[model samples]
Target chain A: MGLDPVKEEQNAALHKMRKRVIESIGRNMDLYGISLSTGHLYGLLFFADKPMTLDEMGSEMKMSKTSMSTGVRTLLDLKMVNKVWEKGSRKDLYEVEYDWYQTFTDFFDIKWRKSVEANILVLRKSMDEIDKIANEYAEDPEMTDMLQKDKAKLRDAYAYYEWLDRLIDTFENGDIYKLVPKEPPAKE
Target chain B: MGLDPVKEEQNAALHKMRKRVIESIGRNMDLYGISLSTGHLYGLLFFADKPMTLDEMGSEMKMSKTSMSTGVRTLLDLKMVNKVWEKGSRKDLYEVEYDWYQTFTDFFDIKWRKSVEANILVLRKSMDEIDKIANEYAEDPEMTDMLQKDKAKLRDAYAYYEWLDRLIDTFENGDIYKLVPKEPPAKE
Candidate 1:
């Protein structure tokens, strides 16, 4: 079911090359404000093999001892990562959340909530502006007609956002899995 | 034909609401590292009705004249957005990237290229460590035997990344459209 000895050596080289690329994804996360550190990043990188120690990650990344400790803590809190307690080690170790599509919900929930809040602030202000225009144009015959149209339009839009905010709130409340269609469910 | 008055009012409200949301999105582009400006965003927003001046957006968002001048220039350079000079007047009017999905390739191209290069560096180093483990164990007959088996399984995975990277590249390059189903082309 596998390759011969000579073929196996070539396969090993390719596999190493693959892991290296996956680890490089670590660098991208940092640039993107993804909040992952080189240690936590590589700690998860080695998850494919076995767990690694705080001291081991420091040497590989050439980071200070204090930085590694804090960095690993940050990863655990975001739940973008996790701690793996090996059977034999007294020290703590970190790893990435392996199911990427699943783990991303934890991350997206934070971002989408912020955007929704910001948009709500914006919509509320627009509603007030429309009301102001309606008040100012109440007696101007032609402008009253135009202002009425704008006010009515703005009110409807506000209602939609009101509904959307409720839907997203439902998403944040731990039952998002029931709502969102999972990507590529189990294959036969 | 459209809906009844109550229904029509609802549709117009949704339209207005979307406009406000889009306007907020345009203003918040900077937070996401997107290049559009408030003037350009509002210019595009109001253009469906008529070309609006920087003054219109400044009045809406209560921004200074200087800010509008600067924001408009940045949007023009991105090419998905641009300015139109009105006859007999020097007012700068902006328009949206109506075919934005297509233009996203150009936008993402700029963002991804800069970011991907940085991420690859991190991944490469993480990968180098895995290689070290392979080389060290290569000398011991039993370790070599185990690595040979381990490496084969991982190489299959690495090939996947190479395939993914290449697949996305092809998807961006246009040939993918030939095989991919598309919505009916819209009339000009």
Candidate 2:
């Protein structure tokens, strides 16, 4: 059967638009230090009408099998993509996870929280050492003044990390969406 | 005059404590993707009683002149450290700026807000592309369904970035501190 001219033209336009969307997703993820291939894979799966086999994705993205597998593994570890088993098809197909927001928050939550906790431990250790020095120099007002100042700075650093912990909690709770300005900036 | 035994012991203890603080700062900065020497330089200046010349800092930190200069320059550019002129001293001396909180917030504010803005642009671009595809596939209900779902995800991504921009603003304003639990968590 011959292809309809109008339908063929429409398909071409749709393909171009989908390619643009995938490129934009890859670019945005690059800004966050995520690899472009992983972003592109996720974007492709996100808009696909059905799950795609790794072979199909590799051919469409022009990536080698090795590269495609590596990208898929990364997305899987990040919980941004999942493997699917198609009926009567032995090959594993992949699709983008719908809870992308949760995926991102979970990744950052573990990362930033661990950092903050480590900093807190260091702050405590430093503070203990400072207290010991302060006690040894109890009679020297001059030395005490210097130690006190350092103590205050360490306290501030501690508080900063503590704030980060709370902020991350707020974000994970989904309450942060309510805090942002909803309207787009006014165009002159 | 001979060194007093008690005073000598105290001085040694204080030196050890200072070194520990510098190491902790360096480690924490490493977590944030900052160079270790730069973090150490800032940490040293933060606790110093007076501004220090490059020669003094380099000798005390046991760093090469070139390394000292590079680290100091990084801190200066970040606005976390400032150069001071000492009377009768031709060499420039450095001290940690008092507005260290602002310096840190400003650094993260620019970094994260830029990322969020870039993501917003990508989301908008992707959404526009999807809209065009939706129009072209108007007659195909299946294609339209997929396009609409992708469009919804893009909108969610946009809102996620919008939340990040606002979160950064709150941090910059220093209001985030109020949200954290002021009391230190009790040891079990």
Candidate 3:
């Protein structure tokens, strides 16, 4: 056999490590409320030294182009992956483009903010309806009191969302980013 | 007909509002990564003036007792609902037990912390595998360099999770809670 024992062992070890890292990426992505495929695609590019075309990704990941395209599109929208066109080649290549901090900030600023805004609108709409009923029973103090309590609860829920939105802004824009020492302090 | 037209219109309007509020609760719970049924059950209790028995919730929500029991159990586990045994009644009644802030903090403290811990373990396992591979390729400068870069990325990812854990701790223990006025300040 032409195989060298040491080289074979090294190849096997690297393959196993890559598999573990890719699976970890999948699990982490699920935790972040993202699809596993998107995470896996990113993991591949992250571990690779150069960009990969869609066909190569599909073959390596055992995924269809349709699924790969969808996953890649989501990563693109998240600004986690960048697409490139080779100077002399017709195929497009994709590579990891975002840092962890950028990904975290974007997820909070866009996805979390949208969810909070939607919650606020829902609370306001419900309060409006509750107000209409409370007014209809203006003469019934007990009924009005009950409605007022319900409305107040809704307002409290709305305020909580507002607080969460502000917290995200503080996390993204304030000292939390600075608190994390991105680079090691320079030697004196 | 026994129906009073004006009363019927008022009831219809109130019913629609209740439906909207319940739906909003379900939506919000989804955002918090809880089940829709749990949210719906809590929504019903939140808007009710009196505590409800399991049978009453099942009937009102058009759900079977089995589903209602499961949903109620989730809310009970989260401390969002409490069971009250009426003085003269044989049935157990359930009522809303937490303010919105309490619910949010509990979710982050318990659920979110657990998620972060799980993610940290995954990253650690991945880093270990990468370390093994890097050590295997110690003789090859190019391979070691690539592996070192990969290991650094994993460490960066690990650091991000650690930062997120600290962020949750800050939210739970820091002045954010004190900063948020639970109730509006009284007029001077």
Candidate 4:
């Protein structure tokens, strides 16, 4: 079919709109520990009409195919994108996760959960060591007092991390949505 | 008073414990867009007995005074630390905010709220532009449909941001603490 003027103009408008939002997304992605360019790449895929190949993405993004591959790999690892098998296509195809709420959950669930769990592990190990030292130094009143104070502080910190662990659980288990509903209330 | 042997040993143990936790905090600092060293700086202050001067922090961290100053500035900007005046002391002193929950709220309130507000602004501007274009092309039924679809998508994205704005308010106003209590429950 011949190119229609109105259709062409409409396409341009849509592209511009998506580009504006994508740039904003790119700029703010550092909060999520993602690079600006990677954010742009994800935004491109998000607005793509269909799953994109690395070659297609590279050309559109004006990035090297190697870079595109790396970015896509990061997105895939974060569950921000999915790899799909396209019938009759030899190359890998990738698509963005459309649900922003799910994207938020996945990103936090992975990143925060890992950090929280690692810190908790360290806290427990440190507390255990403190307990051993406290027992060994019980005969010395000054040493016992110091150990007790430090142990109490560690216990307080541990409580905070425990609460954080539970907070991460809310995200992972979808309980956070109950408190902060995924859907925004209807606009006034 | 002279340092007794038992007291010295206890101090060593406490120092080691703090160091371990500090190192872990440093490793995880990237999640908050902070340098590992800055995280270490914050941890040092967190475990400190009193507000420290830049020189003292530099010596303890084995960092240049310049680097310590920069790190302290960043921590200050994040509200992770505070500058305090000490009577009869000429040097500036800084201390870490002790409440981890408040630190969490402040860090996220500043970071995520700025991001959410910025994204919402762009979404609004883009939607307005779409509306202008749709009105300009009112005669074209196809263009109107295209604009409407794009506008809807932007609206959906805006809703998410709006929800995020409210979520940030929870952090700011401490409503999130109600959902995820700052203190962990009493242990059995």
Which regions of candidate 4 deviate over 4 angstroms?
A1-15, A139-142, A184-188, B1-14, B138-146, B183-188
Number of the top-ranking candidate, with DockQ as the measure: 4
For all predictions, the C-alpha RMSD in Å is 10.7, 6.1, 5.3, 3.5
Top lDDT: which candidate number? 4
TM-score (all chains, Cα) for each model: 0.50, 0.70, 0.81, 0.89
Off by over 4 Å in 3: A1-10, A84-89, A175-188, B1-10, B35-38, B76-93, B178-188
How many collisions per candidate? 5, 0, 0, 0
Query: Taking the tens digit of each residue's C-alpha lDDT, what string does model 1 give over B61-175?
Result: 4678677666655555555565777888777776545443344455445555545544444444534554676687676676566555444434443443333344335436854
Question: Ten residues in a row with the worst lDDT in model 3 chain B?
Answer: B1-10
Report the lDDT of model 4 for residue B148: 79
- Candidate 4's displacement at residue A25, Å, is 0.6
lDDT of 4 at B98: 75
Per-residue CA lDDT of candidate 2, range A1-188, in tens?
00223543557655565566667667666533467777887777776657888898888678898888888888777667888987999988888777656766775675566767877887888899889889988999867876787788788878867766766786688655455434545669
Writing each residue's lDDT as its tens digit, candidate 4 over B1-188 gives: 11243556546666687789889877887888999999899888866757899999898889899999999999999998999998999999998887878888888888999999999999999999998888888998866876776677678778888877887787788777778887766689
| Residue A94 C-alpha lDDT in model 1 | 62
Q: Which 10 consecutive positions of candidate 2 chain A have the poorest summed lDDT? A: A1-10
Instruction: Please give, for residues A1-188, the per-residue lDDT of candidate 3 as tens digits.
Output: 00223543557666576667677666667545677777888787777667878887888789898878888888888777888878997888888874777777776776678878887888888888888887889997766776677788788788878777766776577545454444533569
- Candidate 2 has a TM-score of 0.70
Candidate 2 — which pairs collide?
none
Query: Candidate 4 chain A vs. true chain A: TM-score?
Result: 0.87
Better of 2 and 4 by DockQ: 4
